[model samples]
Every structure is written in C-alpha cells, then in structure tokens.
Target: MFVKYCTTLFAGIWLLFIADIAHAQQPLPDKIAANKAKDWQTYRQASIADSKMAVYFRALTSSELEAINSAKSNGQSKANSKLIEIKSELTVESSIAGFLLFLQDYDKIPNWLDNANGSQLIEQITPSHNIFRIQFSAIWPVSPREMLIESRYWQDRQGNVHIKVEDASDHYTSHKNHIAISIIKAHWLIEPLPNDKLYIQYRVIANANGKMPSWLANKVALRSSWRTLKNINQQLPNSDWQYQKLANILEYQELIQEPTSGTNEQTKDIMPSNNAELN
Candidate 1:
C-alpha cells in the first residue's frame, strides 16, 4: 500500500509541471494583434497631415509677398519691412499617422504641434497629396510673428512616401533687418514594419541667409530636433498588446529550442534581440 501511494504522488507532480510549461508557451490572441496594427496606422496618418500643412503655408506666404512687391514696383507704397525679420525655424516629421488624423479637423494643429500658433488647409490636390499653410509664433527672444510654410507629399514607385517643404518668406521685405530665410530642402521617409508598425526617418538641410550667428543656428537645430522626438515618444506607447504578445512567443520559442538551466553561456548566445552579440 505504501509503495502504490508514492507512485501516484510523483505522477501528479509531473503532470502539474507539464501544464505550467504549456501555459507559458501559449501564443498571443488575434484581437491584440489587430488592435496594435490599427494604432500604428493612426500614427502614420498624423505624420503625413503635419507635412501637408507645412507645404501649404510656405506657398501662401510667398504669394502674399509677391503681391506686395508687385504693388511697390507699380508705385503703390513701400510695404512694412519689419515683417521680414521673423523666421520660421522648426520642421517636424513622424512615423505615426496621428498627424494626418489631426489635420482632418483642421483646428487641432496648434494643440499637438509645439510652436504652431495657427494653421489652415489651402487645398486638397489629391488623395495622396495635399497643401497646407501654417503660421508659427516665435517662443521668445525671437520676435512673436507668423511666417508662411508650404509642404508637399507623394509616394514613389517603391511605395516610399516623401515629403518636400518650401519656405516662402523670401519674397517679402523685412522691416526689422531686411533678412530672409527659406527652406532649402526637407525629406521624411516612412518604412513599414511587421504588425503594421512604421519606422519614420527624417532629414532636413536648411540654409539661413540672414545675418544670424552660427551659435544661434546650431542651438535651434539641436533643440528643435530633440524636443520633437521627445514629444513623439511621450505621446506614443512603446509596447501595445501585440508587442507584448510577440515578445512572449519569441521568449517561449527560445526556451523550447534550447532548454537549459543556470548561467549557461550557450543560452546567452542564442537569445533573440541580444545587444551583446552585436557588440
């Protein structure tokens, strides 16, 4: 009787252990993956909307200045020069579609964008292309005023979306210092990832033709870029349900392929997403 009891007890323990392992290795649910994909799509749309607003503003500002110049040439009267002193100093891009979503309402630009005081959509050129004009107010030490910015967006044959921005402040006269600056060029590329996420990459090469100091220029570039990224990260979640699910599956797969206990060097080498291996 004692021998039979011991065998039953050990069998029960073994079954429990197997059940726990199976539970840990279970795959993620389908609903979680769908939700995560939807969220990523929203993020990307927002980014595209912001770029469109920038492009539209740039063109409008340029046209207004041209009209002023044409009037002056025809002996209308010298226009105000102080308007030219204010500069548009910030450019931003995001992989999340949230930017475009905000644009649909047209009143939320100032809320999400750091320095934008006001914005308006001038035209809808196409389903993929749009034009928007934005007026940004200086934060401080820089005069508080609005400068026009224009932006354009289109996808290439490779399905890569590209955004181009133009600054139209050059056409107007600056009453403050007769200085003018224009956006030489800007680009934003969105790369889609697994589970509908996107990797956003942005690059801008701008020229300041005004008599501004080099130190100030560098400061603006660094501060603006850092602030934009910080804002995006704060707004977006790092790990949604789908991300957590994927991580769990990956960890389980790793364990199954090399089930070992203790400070095993071999296990460390096979670990996924290990930074040590790259180093």
Candidate 2:
C-alpha cells in the first residue's frame, strides 16, 4: 500500500511538471499560435522557458501514467503498454540534401544518439525503405534492449522530408540476452526553412517491452531525446553535408534539374502543422 501511494504521489508530481511545461512557451509567432489554437489543443509546450523553439507532449491517460510509474503492474496490459509520446523541434544550419546524407550513414547514428550501444543496417529493402537494428545499453539490474526498426523516408512536393520509423522485431529471431522492444512509432520531419536553416521535428511513441521500471524508462526517454537533439545541433555543421548527396531523394533530383536553385523559398510562410495529422 505504501509503495502504491508513493508511486501515485510521484506520478502526480510528474503530471504537474508536464502541465507546467505545456504552458511555459514564449509567445508564439502568428502562424504557430494559430496552429496551436486550432490543431494542437491536446499538446502542451514542453520546452525550456524563454526559448523561441518549443517541444510538446500529449497528456497521458491515468492507465498510461500508471504504466510509467510501475511497469510490472500495468505495462504488461495491451491497452496501457506504450510509453508517453514526445515531440520536439530543432532548427539547424543544414541543407535538406546534406541532412539526408548524414542520416544515410547508418553506422554513425550511435555517435549522436544517447545510450545506443550499436547501430547497424540489416538490409536495404528499398532505396528509401530499409531495416536496421539498434542495441540500447541500460544501467544495472535492467536488461539491455534491442530493436529491429523499419525506416521509410520520402519527400513531399513542398520539399519537406518525412521519415517513418517503426518496430520490425518479428522479422528476425530475438537475441538471448537482449529484451526486444515490440512497439515503436517514430517520425522525423525535415522541413526547409528560410535562410538555409532546416526546421526538424521528431516525435516518438514507444514501449520498453521489458520488466524495467516505468519511471526510469520515462526519465531515460526524455533525457535521451533532448541529448539527441543537442548532438545533432553540434555535429551537423562539423561535416560537409552540403557536398554529400543521396541520388534517390526528390530533392536530389530537383538539384540535378537546377543545380543553382537555392533553398525552398516558398516555405517561408509555412510553419509546422500538428504532427497528429500525419497519421
């Protein structure tokens, strides 16, 4: 009874923090404000105070919050198995082609992603769709985790790139020592912004699929996400991403047609829309 009470208390505090973060955004620009008022009522601003950029998270159900507090009791259920959703944005100085090129280098993924033990390309199902496996290292008492992910990427007519990442653990046999994560739905939105900057938005919903405590898993998820963004911001400029290229993408085709064409000038008036619409 005491353990349950403590869990409930901690969860209450966590939700309060979520509520605080949701309302902590600096003033939004007109377009973003309009989108927030219209399509993003369920999302709360989760970014740091006074920052122009904002991150958002959806409110979790009571069962979902319970699952996070104690995985053994609630996480095994089919309904409340998923982790909390995280949506974040990063503005970085990189061309669409360069960023795509950086992503295509699969082996280097662990360098930027926190807690990643190994990242490898399993098979190239298609030029844009491929299967990869990632190993995640956890602290003592929690078994290490592994995921087989199917990544599919494409570009829109508006010159924005979208990558969908999903769990594909059933494709291969599971390892003996690693806990296989069974659910993952993640997306990456790389939009071309004005002044040669790219507005990158990433959203992920996953489940640990193991006996690890939910609170610890949630903590790791949030911190790793923020760290990943920071790493991307720091590492993108260090490489010559502009000179790098992938021939399969539409942006690369457009570049072939007009080598001198600059950034997506039409997207200047465009702000990111609610990511829920992508589903």
Clashes of each: 29, 1
Q: For residues 65-129, write the lDDT of model 2, one tens digit per residue.
A: 55544633322323242345667788777778788767767788888877787888889977677
TM-score of candidate 2 relative to the true fold? 0.66
Model 2 alpha-carbon drift over 4 Å, by segment: 1-54, 61-82, 250-279
Among these predicted structures, which one has the highest lDDT? 2
Q: Can you give the TM-score per candidate against the true fold? A: 0.43, 0.66
lDDT of candidate 1?
0.38
Residue 58, model 2: Cα distance from true site in angstroms:
2.3
Please give the distance, in angstroms, between residue 220's alpha carbon in candidate 2 and its true position after superposition: 0.8
lDDT of each residue in 7-32, candidate 1, tens digit only: 99878876764454234222222122
Q: Which candidate is the best by TM-score?
A: 2
Misplaced by over 4 Å in model 1 are 1-106, 145-147, 169-181, 208-211, 236-279
